[model samples]
Target chain A: GAGVSQSPRYKVAKRGQDVALRCDPISGHVSLFWYQQALGQGPEFLTYFQNEAQLDKSGLPSDRFFAERPEGSVSTLKIQRTQQEDSAVYLCASSRPPGEKLFFGSGTQLSVL
Target chain B: EDKVVQSPLSLVVHEGDTVTLNCSYEVTNFRSLLWYKQEKKAPTFLFMLTSSGIEKKSGRLSSILDKKELSSILNITATQTGDSAIYLCAAKGYGGATNKLIFGTGTLLAVQP
Candidate 1:
Protein backbone atom coordinates (compact mmCIF):
# COMPACT_ATOMS: atom_id res chain seq x y z
CA GLY A 1 0.00 0.00 0.00
CA ALA A 2 0.96 3.63 -0.36
CA GLY A 3 0.86 4.17 3.38
CA VAL A 4 0.04 2.42 6.62
CA SER A 5 -3.61 1.33 6.80
CA GLN A 6 -5.73 0.62 9.88
CA SER A 7 -9.20 -0.83 10.08
CA PRO A 8 -12.33 0.16 11.99
CA ARG A 9 -11.42 3.83 12.34
CA TYR A 10 -13.82 3.96 15.27
CA LYS A 11 -15.03 1.27 17.63
CA VAL A 12 -17.50 1.20 20.48
CA ALA A 13 -17.23 -1.74 22.86
CA LYS A 14 -18.92 -2.54 26.13
CA ARG A 15 -16.94 -3.24 29.25
CA GLY A 16 -15.68 -6.83 29.41
CA GLN A 17 -15.93 -7.18 25.65
CA ASP A 18 -12.93 -7.91 23.53
CA VAL A 19 -11.91 -5.77 20.59
CA ALA A 20 -9.47 -6.36 17.80
CA LEU A 21 -7.65 -3.64 15.85
CA ARG A 22 -5.85 -4.32 12.62
CA CYS A 23 -2.95 -2.62 10.88
CA ASP A 24 -1.44 -3.16 7.44
CA PRO A 25 1.90 -1.49 7.18
CA ILE A 26 3.75 -0.34 4.11
CA SER A 27 4.97 -3.24 2.00
CA GLY A 28 8.28 -4.70 3.10
CA HIS A 29 8.57 -2.60 6.22
CA VAL A 30 10.88 -4.43 8.57
CA SER A 31 9.74 -2.90 11.83
CA LEU A 32 6.15 -2.49 13.11
CA PHE A 33 5.07 -0.78 16.30
CA TRP A 34 1.86 -0.38 18.26
CA TYR A 35 1.01 2.63 20.41
CA GLN A 36 -1.87 3.85 22.52
CA GLN A 37 -2.80 7.52 22.80
CA ALA A 38 -5.02 8.68 25.60
CA LEU A 39 -7.12 11.80 25.47
CA GLY A 40 -4.96 14.93 25.71
CA GLN A 41 -1.80 12.81 25.84
CA GLY A 42 0.95 11.65 23.56
CA PRO A 43 1.15 8.21 22.05
CA GLU A 44 2.69 5.55 24.29
CA PHE A 45 4.53 2.60 22.94
CA LEU A 46 2.79 -0.75 23.31
CA THR A 47 4.87 -3.26 21.42
CA TYR A 48 7.39 -3.65 18.62
CA PHE A 49 8.12 -6.24 15.96
CA GLN A 50 10.96 -6.91 13.58
CA ASN A 51 9.73 -8.83 10.57
CA GLU A 52 7.54 -11.57 12.04
CA ALA A 53 9.28 -11.65 15.39
CA GLN A 54 7.82 -9.91 18.39
CA LEU A 55 10.94 -8.51 19.93
CA ASP A 56 9.45 -6.24 22.54
CA LYS A 57 6.18 -6.10 24.43
CA SER A 58 7.35 -4.24 27.47
CA GLY A 59 5.01 -1.30 27.04
CA LEU A 60 1.80 -3.30 26.93
CA PRO A 61 -0.18 -1.93 29.83
CA SER A 62 -1.54 -5.21 31.15
CA ASP A 63 -2.04 -8.86 30.47
CA ARG A 64 -5.28 -7.98 28.70
CA PHE A 65 -3.40 -6.14 25.96
CA PHE A 66 -1.83 -8.34 23.30
CA ALA A 67 -0.41 -7.74 19.81
CA GLU A 68 0.96 -9.98 17.10
CA ARG A 69 2.40 -9.74 13.59
CA PRO A 70 2.45 -13.29 12.33
CA GLU A 71 3.45 -12.66 8.72
CA GLY A 72 5.32 -9.37 9.16
CA SER A 73 3.14 -7.29 6.83
CA VAL A 74 -0.06 -7.12 8.86
CA SER A 75 -0.61 -6.89 12.62
CA THR A 76 -3.40 -7.16 15.13
CA LEU A 77 -3.93 -5.67 18.59
CA LYS A 78 -6.37 -7.49 20.82
CA ILE A 79 -7.65 -6.21 24.09
CA GLN A 80 -9.42 -8.68 26.33
CA ARG A 81 -12.21 -7.64 28.69
CA THR A 82 -11.91 -4.03 27.76
CA GLN A 83 -12.36 -1.43 30.42
CA GLN A 84 -13.36 2.24 30.42
CA GLU A 85 -9.71 3.13 30.87
CA ASP A 86 -9.03 1.47 27.51
CA SER A 87 -11.04 4.07 25.68
CA ALA A 88 -8.44 5.74 23.57
CA VAL A 89 -6.83 5.75 20.14
CA TYR A 90 -4.73 2.75 19.10
CA LEU A 91 -2.06 3.69 16.58
CA CYS A 92 0.19 1.53 14.43
CA ALA A 93 3.44 2.61 12.83
CA SER A 94 6.05 1.04 10.60
CA SER A 95 9.64 1.73 9.69
CA ARG A 96 11.99 0.24 7.18
CA PRO A 97 14.50 -0.63 9.89
CA PRO A 98 14.89 -0.27 13.62
CA GLY A 99 16.24 3.28 13.61
CA GLU A 100 14.52 4.69 10.54
CA LYS A 101 11.66 7.11 9.99
CA LEU A 102 8.24 5.77 10.86
CA PHE A 103 4.96 5.92 8.93
CA PHE A 104 1.77 5.99 10.95
CA GLY A 105 -1.75 4.82 10.35
CA SER A 106 -5.00 6.72 10.84
CA GLY A 107 -5.54 4.72 14.08
CA THR A 108 -8.56 3.03 15.63
CA GLN A 109 -10.44 5.00 18.24
CA LEU A 110 -11.81 2.60 20.82
CA SER A 111 -14.66 3.82 22.97
CA VAL A 112 -15.49 1.54 25.85
CA LEU A 113 -18.97 2.25 27.03
CA GLU B 1 12.68 5.05 33.28
CA ASP B 2 12.98 7.17 30.15
CA LYS B 3 11.00 10.40 30.14
CA VAL B 4 10.20 13.14 27.67
CA VAL B 5 8.70 16.49 28.53
CA GLN B 6 7.32 19.16 26.21
CA SER B 7 6.59 22.73 27.25
CA PRO B 8 3.48 24.88 26.71
CA LEU B 9 0.59 22.46 26.70
CA SER B 10 -1.33 24.67 24.30
CA LEU B 11 -0.84 27.81 22.28
CA VAL B 12 -3.04 30.05 20.15
CA VAL B 13 -1.39 32.22 17.57
CA HIS B 14 -2.34 34.26 14.53
CA GLU B 15 -1.36 33.24 11.07
CA GLY B 16 2.13 34.25 9.92
CA ASP B 17 3.34 34.14 13.52
CA THR B 18 6.29 32.01 14.30
CA VAL B 19 6.19 29.44 17.09
CA THR B 20 8.78 27.48 18.96
CA LEU B 21 8.04 24.20 20.71
CA ASN B 22 10.40 22.82 23.31
CA CYS B 23 11.17 19.26 24.36
CA SER B 24 13.53 17.79 26.92
CA TYR B 25 14.33 14.22 27.71
CA GLU B 26 16.15 12.04 30.21
CA VAL B 27 16.91 8.59 28.93
CA THR B 28 19.61 5.94 28.88
CA ASN B 29 21.19 5.06 25.53
CA PHE B 30 19.37 7.80 23.67
CA ARG B 31 19.25 7.12 19.96
CA SER B 32 17.23 9.96 18.46
CA LEU B 33 14.52 12.54 18.99
CA LEU B 34 11.52 12.90 16.72
CA TRP B 35 8.80 15.44 16.06
CA TYR B 36 5.26 14.67 14.92
CA LYS B 37 2.09 16.59 14.10
CA GLN B 38 -1.29 15.22 15.01
CA GLU B 39 -4.53 16.71 13.76
CA LYS B 40 -7.64 14.53 13.45
CA LYS B 41 -6.51 10.92 13.57
CA ALA B 42 -2.88 9.95 13.20
CA PRO B 43 0.33 11.84 13.71
CA THR B 44 2.51 12.71 10.77
CA PHE B 45 6.26 12.62 11.08
CA LEU B 46 8.07 15.94 10.95
CA PHE B 47 11.73 15.73 11.81
CA MET B 48 14.20 13.33 13.40
CA LEU B 49 17.26 14.65 15.13
CA THR B 50 20.24 12.44 15.87
CA SER B 51 23.30 14.63 15.93
CA SER B 52 23.54 17.84 17.85
CA GLY B 53 23.83 21.37 16.37
CA ILE B 54 22.78 20.48 12.82
CA GLU B 55 19.34 21.83 12.01
CA LYS B 56 16.85 19.91 9.92
CA LYS B 57 14.64 22.17 7.84
CA SER B 58 11.64 21.46 5.72
CA GLY B 59 10.31 24.66 4.27
CA ARG B 60 8.62 26.54 7.11
CA LEU B 61 9.49 23.88 9.68
CA SER B 62 12.87 23.49 11.29
CA SER B 63 14.19 21.52 14.25
CA ILE B 64 17.42 21.14 16.14
CA LEU B 65 18.67 18.86 18.86
CA ASP B 66 21.02 19.84 21.65
CA LYS B 67 22.58 16.67 22.97
CA LYS B 68 24.57 18.56 25.56
CA GLU B 69 21.40 19.88 27.15
CA LEU B 70 19.28 16.82 26.44
CA SER B 71 16.69 18.94 24.63
CA SER B 72 15.25 19.68 21.21
CA ILE B 73 13.24 22.51 19.70
CA LEU B 74 10.89 22.71 16.77
CA ASN B 75 10.50 26.10 15.13
CA ILE B 76 7.85 26.99 12.61
CA THR B 77 8.44 30.10 10.53
CA ALA B 78 5.34 31.97 9.33
CA THR B 79 2.90 29.47 10.64
CA GLN B 80 -0.37 28.89 8.81
CA THR B 81 -3.82 27.72 9.76
CA GLY B 82 -2.98 24.35 8.32
CA ASP B 83 -0.19 24.12 10.82
CA SER B 84 -2.61 24.10 13.72
CA ALA B 85 -2.18 20.75 15.37
CA ILE B 86 -0.69 18.94 18.31
CA TYR B 87 3.06 18.87 18.10
CA LEU B 88 4.57 15.83 19.76
CA CYS B 89 8.14 15.20 20.83
CA ALA B 90 9.56 11.76 21.36
CA ALA B 91 12.89 10.33 22.37
CA LYS B 92 14.08 6.93 21.21
CA GLY B 93 16.04 4.66 23.46
CA TYR B 94 17.57 1.23 23.07
CA GLY B 95 16.81 -1.03 25.96
CA GLY B 96 17.09 -4.75 25.34
CA ALA B 97 16.51 -6.06 21.85
CA THR B 98 14.30 -3.39 20.32
CA ASN B 99 14.29 0.37 20.52
CA LYS B 100 11.34 2.12 22.13
CA LEU B 101 10.13 5.70 22.02
CA ILE B 102 9.02 7.82 24.95
CA PHE B 103 6.75 10.69 24.02
CA GLY B 104 5.73 13.86 25.78
CA THR B 105 2.19 15.08 26.33
CA GLY B 106 2.40 17.26 23.21
CA THR B 107 1.72 20.92 22.51
CA LEU B 108 -1.59 21.88 20.98
CA LEU B 109 -1.08 24.77 18.57
CA ALA B 110 -4.00 26.70 17.14
CA VAL B 111 -3.31 29.18 14.40
CA GLN B 112 -6.03 31.74 13.89
CA PRO B 113 -6.59 33.07 10.41
Candidate 2:
Protein backbone atom coordinates (compact mmCIF):
# COMPACT_ATOMS: atom_id res chain seq x y z
CA GLY A 1 0.00 0.00 0.00
CA ALA A 2 1.10 3.56 -0.58
CA GLY A 3 0.24 4.48 3.01
CA VAL A 4 -0.57 2.91 6.36
CA SER A 5 -3.96 1.26 6.38
CA GLN A 6 -6.28 0.69 9.32
CA SER A 7 -9.38 -1.46 9.61
CA PRO A 8 -12.80 -0.91 11.12
CA ARG A 9 -13.09 2.77 10.38
CA TYR A 10 -15.70 3.07 13.10
CA LYS A 11 -16.63 0.85 16.03
CA VAL A 12 -19.41 1.20 18.51
CA ALA A 13 -19.32 -1.16 21.46
CA LYS A 14 -21.29 -1.41 24.64
CA ARG A 15 -19.49 -0.82 27.88
CA GLY A 16 -17.55 -3.90 28.96
CA GLN A 17 -17.32 -5.21 25.43
CA ASP A 18 -14.03 -6.08 23.86
CA VAL A 19 -12.88 -4.58 20.55
CA ALA A 20 -9.97 -5.07 18.24
CA LEU A 21 -8.45 -2.63 15.76
CA ARG A 22 -6.02 -3.59 13.06
CA CYS A 23 -3.26 -1.75 11.21
CA ASP A 24 -1.21 -2.64 8.16
CA PRO A 25 1.83 -0.48 7.86
CA ILE A 26 3.70 0.47 4.73
CA SER A 27 5.75 -2.36 3.32
CA GLY A 28 9.20 -2.77 4.86
CA HIS A 29 8.75 0.05 7.30
CA VAL A 30 10.84 -0.60 10.38
CA SER A 31 8.89 1.43 12.89
CA LEU A 32 5.22 1.38 13.80
CA PHE A 33 3.35 3.54 16.30
CA TRP A 34 -0.10 3.71 17.82
CA TYR A 35 -1.76 6.83 19.18
CA GLN A 36 -5.09 7.70 20.72
CA GLN A 37 -6.85 11.02 20.07
CA ALA A 38 -9.73 12.15 22.18
CA LEU A 39 -12.27 14.72 21.05
CA GLY A 40 -10.73 18.20 20.86
CA GLN A 41 -7.28 16.84 21.70
CA GLY A 42 -4.12 15.84 19.91
CA PRO A 43 -3.06 12.26 19.47
CA GLU A 44 -1.28 10.75 22.44
CA PHE A 45 1.30 8.02 22.15
CA LEU A 46 0.13 4.52 22.99
CA THR A 47 2.97 2.21 22.02
CA TYR A 48 5.80 1.66 19.54
CA PHE A 49 7.42 -1.23 17.70
CA GLN A 50 10.69 -1.72 15.95
CA ASN A 51 10.12 -4.59 13.58
CA GLU A 52 8.70 -7.43 15.68
CA ALA A 53 10.20 -6.18 18.88
CA GLN A 54 7.84 -4.49 21.30
CA LEU A 55 10.32 -1.80 22.27
CA ASP A 56 7.89 0.44 24.12
CA LYS A 57 4.56 -0.05 25.82
CA SER A 58 4.78 2.47 28.59
CA GLY A 59 2.13 4.69 27.03
CA LEU A 60 -0.58 2.07 27.16
CA PRO A 61 -3.16 3.55 29.49
CA SER A 62 -3.88 0.40 31.50
CA ASP A 63 -3.48 -3.34 31.67
CA ARG A 64 -6.62 -3.79 29.64
CA PHE A 65 -5.16 -2.08 26.60
CA PHE A 66 -2.85 -4.37 24.65
CA ALA A 67 -1.04 -4.12 21.29
CA GLU A 68 1.11 -6.55 19.36
CA ARG A 69 2.99 -6.72 16.10
CA PRO A 70 3.96 -10.35 16.02
CA GLU A 71 5.29 -10.65 12.46
CA GLY A 72 6.70 -7.13 12.21
CA SER A 73 4.21 -6.05 9.58
CA VAL A 74 0.62 -6.04 10.73
CA SER A 75 -0.40 -4.88 14.20
CA THR A 76 -3.46 -5.15 16.34
CA LEU A 77 -4.73 -3.20 19.33
CA LYS A 78 -7.24 -4.83 21.61
CA ILE A 79 -9.15 -3.23 24.40
CA GLN A 80 -10.91 -5.26 27.03
CA ARG A 81 -13.88 -4.09 29.08
CA THR A 82 -14.20 -0.89 27.16
CA GLN A 83 -15.41 2.13 29.08
CA GLN A 84 -17.09 5.29 27.90
CA GLU A 85 -13.83 7.10 28.39
CA ASP A 86 -12.28 4.77 25.84
CA SER A 87 -14.20 6.44 23.07
CA ALA A 88 -11.67 8.07 20.79
CA VAL A 89 -9.83 7.81 17.49
CA TYR A 90 -7.00 5.29 17.38
CA LEU A 91 -4.31 6.15 14.84
CA CYS A 92 -1.56 3.98 13.33
CA ALA A 93 1.63 5.35 11.83
CA SER A 94 4.69 3.81 10.21
CA SER A 95 8.14 5.09 9.38
CA ARG A 96 11.20 3.76 7.67
CA PRO A 97 14.52 3.31 9.40
CA PRO A 98 15.76 6.37 11.31
CA GLY A 99 12.07 7.14 11.88
CA GLU A 100 12.13 10.83 11.05
CA LYS A 101 8.95 10.99 9.00
CA LEU A 102 5.82 9.09 9.92
CA PHE A 103 3.03 8.17 7.50
CA PHE A 104 -0.27 7.86 9.26
CA GLY A 105 -3.49 5.99 8.54
CA SER A 106 -7.06 7.12 8.74
CA GLY A 107 -7.86 6.14 12.32
CA THR A 108 -10.55 3.93 13.70
CA GLN A 109 -13.10 5.85 15.72
CA LEU A 110 -14.27 3.84 18.71
CA SER A 111 -17.35 4.82 20.60
CA VAL A 112 -18.15 2.97 23.80
CA LEU A 113 -21.76 3.24 24.71
CA GLU B 1 7.54 14.14 32.58
CA ASP B 2 7.88 15.23 28.95
CA LYS B 3 5.15 17.67 27.87
CA VAL B 4 4.07 19.68 24.83
CA VAL B 5 1.73 22.67 25.00
CA GLN B 6 0.05 24.53 22.14
CA SER B 7 -1.53 27.94 22.53
CA PRO B 8 -4.77 29.49 21.17
CA LEU B 9 -6.88 26.38 21.42
CA SER B 10 -9.08 27.75 18.64
CA LEU B 11 -8.84 30.51 16.08
CA VAL B 12 -11.19 31.94 13.49
CA VAL B 13 -9.86 33.68 10.44
CA HIS B 14 -11.01 34.84 7.02
CA GLU B 15 -9.58 33.88 3.69
CA GLY B 16 -6.23 35.43 2.74
CA ASP B 17 -5.48 36.10 6.39
CA THR B 18 -2.25 35.11 8.10
CA VAL B 19 -2.12 33.17 11.33
CA THR B 20 0.51 31.77 13.62
CA LEU B 21 0.22 28.82 15.95
CA ASN B 22 2.51 28.39 18.95
CA CYS B 23 3.89 25.31 20.68
CA SER B 24 6.14 24.99 23.72
CA TYR B 25 7.69 21.88 25.12
CA GLU B 26 9.76 20.58 28.03
CA VAL B 27 11.39 17.28 27.45
CA THR B 28 14.51 15.28 28.20
CA ASN B 29 16.97 14.66 25.37
CA PHE B 30 14.96 16.46 22.74
CA ARG B 31 15.63 15.18 19.27
CA SER B 32 13.25 17.22 17.08
CA LEU B 33 9.94 19.02 16.83
CA LEU B 34 7.28 18.15 14.25
CA TRP B 35 4.13 19.77 12.94
CA TYR B 36 1.10 17.91 11.65
CA LYS B 37 -2.16 19.00 10.05
CA GLN B 38 -5.16 16.94 11.02
CA GLU B 39 -8.47 16.89 9.24
CA LYS B 40 -11.37 14.46 9.59
CA LYS B 41 -9.34 11.37 10.44
CA ALA B 42 -5.64 11.40 9.71
CA PRO B 43 -2.88 13.85 10.46
CA THR B 44 -0.50 14.66 7.64
CA PHE B 45 3.12 15.46 8.40
CA LEU B 46 4.16 19.03 7.71
CA PHE B 47 7.62 19.88 8.96
CA MET B 48 10.30 18.57 11.32
CA LEU B 49 12.64 21.08 12.88
CA THR B 50 15.86 20.05 14.57
CA SER B 51 18.06 23.10 14.22
CA SER B 52 17.02 26.36 15.77
CA GLY B 53 16.31 29.54 13.74
CA ILE B 54 16.04 27.74 10.41
CA GLU B 55 12.58 27.89 8.95
CA LYS B 56 10.94 25.21 6.81
CA LYS B 57 8.34 26.26 4.29
CA SER B 58 5.84 24.55 2.04
CA GLY B 59 3.54 26.64 -0.07
CA ARG B 60 1.53 28.71 2.40
CA LEU B 61 2.78 26.92 5.49
CA SER B 62 6.00 27.47 7.35
CA SER B 63 7.47 26.60 10.73
CA ILE B 64 10.50 27.28 12.90
CA LEU B 65 11.96 25.94 16.09
CA ASP B 66 13.90 27.56 18.90
CA LYS B 67 15.85 25.16 21.07
CA LYS B 68 16.87 27.77 23.65
CA GLU B 69 13.28 28.66 24.34
CA LEU B 70 12.04 25.07 23.93
CA SER B 71 9.33 26.21 21.57
CA SER B 72 8.19 26.22 17.94
CA ILE B 73 5.84 28.25 15.80
CA LEU B 74 3.81 27.48 12.66
CA ASN B 75 2.88 30.26 10.26
CA ILE B 76 0.34 30.09 7.50
CA THR B 77 0.12 32.90 4.97
CA ALA B 78 -2.80 33.67 2.66
CA THR B 79 -4.84 31.06 4.42
CA GLN B 80 -7.75 29.44 2.58
CA THR B 81 -10.82 27.57 3.64
CA GLY B 82 -9.06 24.39 2.67
CA ASP B 83 -6.47 25.14 5.32
CA SER B 84 -9.00 24.96 8.11
CA ALA B 85 -8.06 22.11 10.38
CA ILE B 86 -6.36 21.24 13.62
CA TYR B 87 -2.62 21.86 13.72
CA LEU B 88 -0.63 19.73 16.11
CA CYS B 89 2.87 19.93 17.47
CA ALA B 90 4.93 17.08 18.84
CA ALA B 91 8.32 16.86 20.47
CA LYS B 92 10.47 13.81 20.09
CA GLY B 93 12.48 12.65 23.06
CA TYR B 94 15.03 9.95 23.46
CA GLY B 95 14.69 7.78 26.52
CA GLY B 96 17.42 5.27 27.21
CA ALA B 97 16.16 2.66 24.78
CA THR B 98 13.21 3.99 22.83
CA ASN B 99 12.37 7.23 21.09
CA LYS B 100 8.88 8.57 21.68
CA LEU B 101 6.86 11.65 20.90
CA ILE B 102 4.84 13.89 23.20
CA PHE B 103 2.13 15.92 21.52
CA GLY B 104 0.35 19.14 22.42
CA THR B 105 -3.40 19.60 22.65
CA GLY B 106 -3.47 21.18 19.13
CA THR B 107 -4.71 24.48 17.73
CA LEU B 108 -8.02 24.47 15.88
CA LEU B 109 -8.04 26.84 12.89
CA ALA B 110 -11.27 27.79 11.22
CA VAL B 111 -10.99 29.70 7.98
CA GLN B 112 -14.04 31.42 6.63
CA PRO B 113 -14.53 32.56 3.10
Per-candidate iRMSD: 1.1, 1.1
Q: Model 2 over residues A12-101: C-alpha lDDT tens digits?
A: 999999999999999999899999999998898999999999898988999999999999999999999999999999999999988877
Residue A23 error, candidate 2, Å: 0.3
Model 1, range B6-46, lDDT digits (tens) per residue? 99999999999999999999989888999999999788999
Best by DockQ: 1
User: Which 10-residue window in model 1 chain B sums to the lowest lDDT?
Assistant: B92-101
- Over A55-106, each residue of candidate 1 has an lDDT whose tens digit, in order, gives 9999999999989899878999999999999999999999887555788999
Candidate 2 deviant stretches above 4 angstroms: none
Task: Candidate 2: give the clashing pairs.
Answer: none
What are the candidates' C-alpha RMSDs? 1.0, 0.9
Candidate 2 CAPRI level: medium
Candidate 2 lDDT, tens digit per residue, B76-109? Answer: 9999999999999999876555666788999999
Tell me the TM-score of model 2: 0.98
Segments in model 1 whose C-alpha atoms lie over 4 Å from true places? none
* C-alpha lDDT score of every prediction, in listed order: 0.93, 0.94
Model 1 residue A99 lDDT? Answer: 50
